[model samples]
Target: MLILGAFNLFVGRLYLIPSESMEPTLNGCAGCDGDRIFVNKLAYLGDSSPHPGDVVVFRGPDSWNGSYTSQRSRNDVIRGIQNAASVVGIIAPDENTLVKRVVATGGQTVQCRAGDPGIMVNGKKVDDEFTEKPMSNPVDPATGSQACQGPYFGPVTVPQDNLWVMGDNRTNSLDSRGHMGDELQGTVPVENVVGRVEAIVLPFGRTGFVDNPDIQHN
Candidate 1:
């Protein structure tokens, strides 16, 4: 058990999906059991870095705090226990961690405009097959794209060492797009990434490796 705990703490860990933000790609809901996923902490070690289309777990930037609620116990004793359990992957750590897909990396420019079929990175339309099917949200009249919902934004260049991220669920996700007013233009620092989500490991019926396609090419 001690060895397993150490491994979980430093190598990889299991995390439970708590919301539908990444829906269709990762199953999560309010009341039922969410999909359990394995995050590979070693994925970006050495010279590797997250790339566009890779789903990752990361610490939310300061601008995102308003949307998060901590799950730590108020009592010292219980909180300590929870902390210990989290080390072993028994429960999620009490932190503002979020999961989303990388939309554009450093030096790339991303945007959505009127009549665009999907998001554009470096002026090329990204393939939208991975996004939620039959998008139900009211399309943004300004952008005319269901992907943008109501906020058509950016040709904004991603800062060096930062990442532009968004959820596959688009309309339902309060991802980088929603925090564009911040200093980093809603981009997450590469340093804040906890790990790359590699696979779904729980809820037997949905177990499988998560896809990380080259979204910028299409």
Candidate 2:
């Protein structure tokens, strides 16, 4: 038990999906039982960094706080227990941690327009087959693709050592796209990443390795 706890603390940990932003890829629902996943803590320990299409868990930037609410208990006793349990992967930490897929890495320009087939990164169209279909907004007649829903955005360059991320459920996700006006241009600092998602561990029916395709190549 002690060894397992230490492993969770330094090597890997488990996290429960909190919302529907990553649907169709990762199952989650507000105030409901969601998929539990394993996050590999050592994925970017040295010279390695997050890459496009890698789903990661990170602490949202300060500018994102207004859009999220913590789920921690108000009771001091229960909250303390939850915090302690989190240290051993027994429960997820009560923090503003979020899960999203990397769309553009540092120094890459990413954007989507009304008539585009998909998001373009460094001028190449990204393969976004993993995104949920039939987006929440009306489809654009120009391209017939739900890539940007209604509004178009970006061509924004990601800062060095940062990442531009979005959810698989594009239309419902309030990811980097919704924070374009903030500092870092809504890109998340690489250092803020907690870990890379390795696999879904709970809810046996959905158990499997999460795909981390090289989106820019396609």
State the C-alpha lDDT per candidate.
Answer: 0.88, 0.87
Candidate 2, residues 97-166, lDDT tens digits: the string is 9999999999899888766667889888988889887665565566444556535788799999999999
RMSD of each: 1.4, 2.3
Maximum-TM-score candidate: 1
- Residue-level error in angstroms, candidate 2, position 12: 1.0
Where does model 2 exceed 4 Å of error? 136-145
TM, every model: 0.95, 0.91
lDDT of 1: 0.88
User: Please, what are the lDDT tens digits per residue for candidate 1 over residues 102-201?
Assistant: 9899999999877656689998887667888766366656545665544688878999999999988888888988899999999999999999999999
Clashes of 2: 0
